[model samples]
Target: MAAPTPIDQITDKVERLLLRHEELQRTNALLVEQVHALQAERDSLKSRLMAARARIDALLERLPGASADERKERT
Candidate 1:
């Protein structure tokens, strides 16, 4: 059998590159989706943290020691 010509080799290479490009695009899309999901999760966690902090602050205000402001000023 005859060996492949230069044009055939170049065509093969181009096809491979196209396949690789498509693969990378798919991977990039998946990564973007993951980033969005993670960002949403992080925002939810931040909201929960803020709520917890508010609850803790309220509890501190109810404490019998000096007022919250006075305690902060002393520290």
Candidate 2:
């Protein structure tokens, strides 16, 4: 069999590099999308946590004293 030419070796290397580049690009896009999705979910959870904390604060403020007996008597 004849040995491969220099051009063939260069072409094979280029093809492999291009394939690797394409795979990396795809992975980067997927990661970016995941980051955006996670950020949105984090923001939503933060808002919910804030609202829950505010509700708890309001309920505590409405109560008369530290003791449960006072709350029961008031009710």
Instruction: Assess every candidate by TM-score.
Output: 0.90, 0.81
lDDT at position 23, candidate 1: 100
After aligning candidate 2 to the native by TM-score, how far in Å is the CA of 3 from where it should be?
1.4
lDDT at 14, model 1: 100
lDDT of 2 by residue, 1-75 (tens): 898899999999999999999999999999999999999999999999999978876686576656766544543
What candidate 1 gets wrong by more than 4 Å, as runs, is 73-75
The Cα local distance difference test for each model comes to: 0.90, 0.87
Candidate 1 accuracy as lDDT: 0.90
Off by over 4 Å in 2: 66-75
Q: So what's the TM-score on candidate 1?
A: 0.90
Q: Write the per-residue lDDT of candidate 1 for residues 1-75, one digit (tens) a residue.
A: 999999999999999999999999999999999999999999999999999988877777777967768856743
